[model samples]
Target: MTLKRYNMEKILKIITGLAGALFALIGLGWVIKPAAIAAEMGLPLLEGTALNTQIGDMGAFFFAGGVITLLGVLTGKRQWYYAAALLIGTAGVFRVLAFTVQGATLPIDKLIVEIVVLGILLASAKLTSVPQ
Candidate 1:
């Protein structure tokens, strides 16, 4: 039996769809403020500290990125998909940098997940034949 070569276009489509879903889920998590997430993650719900404010800002950015990615997927806009993916990827890199600078224990699991996602996005961008 021989395995068939995967179609790049099809893979990109799936990647875009999955990325959109993941972003939307992240947005929903931020909007909902579930107790389990808060307790497990030590995320404060209501307090206006510098850290909290920064988190809120990042949350807003993530929410918007999710929406944009969803729209790009639905509309078949390769450029939009690439743009959102790059933005999210860059943000993830910055997040890791910040964690390191703060002398904080890195969220290895989350960073790995984000790295995987970023790889998918980059591959999708290439497979879709979209100009970077």
Candidate 2:
């Protein structure tokens, strides 16, 4: 690879790895301190089964997305990037839906993060490759 391309790969790997770790940590927070995480996310911790769903579903979403992203970076696996991209990109799509269809205020900050991360993952998937 050319020097510039190699440098770009290294940079992307570091960026994606940090993003993955951040997401996993957030997921852990959801499991360990659901109320605090919920408050930060502007969500309420509900009672009974709803609370269970909140912790379980949200935690799994973030944890899995993060783990898959890390795996992609570590293993240079394109498939893992595609998987993470789909997971995060779907969330982005739904955020738009919430704003347009559900009459919720635009979650612009979160959406920007999601789109940026999704772009990085997609670009990484295209640029990175598995070792033979």
Candidate 3:
């Protein structure tokens, strides 16, 4: 392999690893301290069943995405990356829908991060291949 290509791969791996780590930590926060994480996300954690759903559902969503992303990077499995991309990309689409149809404010910050992560996962999936 060329030196430049080798370096580029290294950089991409580093970026993807960081993203996975950050997401996992955020997921942990959701489970351990749902109130703070919910506040940060501009969400409420009301009492009773709603609070349970907020913590359980959101925690699983983020933790699964992070773990799958890490699996892709560690195992050199393109399918895992594709899975993460699909999950995150779908969330991005929802953000757009909320803004356009649900009368919610534009979530530019979250959208930007989602788009960048989606790009990274898709690119990584394309660049890597599974053994035949």
- Candidate topping TM-score: 2
**lDDT for each residue of candidate 2 in 8-125, tens digit (9 for 90 to 100):** 9889999999999989888998989999999989998988999999999999999999999999999998999999999999999999999899999987899999999999999888
* Residues 1-132 of candidate 1: C-alpha lDDT, one tens digit per residue: 112224666766777677777767665666576444455555655555754664566566667777777776566656776777777788778778888787766777767867876777666655554343
Against the hidden true structure, what lDDT does model 3 obtain? 0.87
Instruction: Give the best candidate by lDDT.
Output: 2
Q: Give the Cα lDDT of each candidate.
A: 0.66, 0.92, 0.87
| Cα lDDT, model 1, residue 48 | 52
TM-score for each of the candidates: 0.71, 0.95, 0.93
lDDT of 3 by residue, 1-132 (tens): 688767766777779888988888788998899889989998887789888887878888888899989998898888889899999999999999999999999879999999999999988887764541
**Clashing residue pairs in candidate 2 (N, C-alpha, C atoms within 3 angstroms):** none
Clashing pairs in 1: none
Candidate 1 stretches greater than 4 Å from native: 1-6, 40-42, 48-58, 129-132
Q: Report clashes for each candidate as comma-separated counts.
A: 0, 0, 0
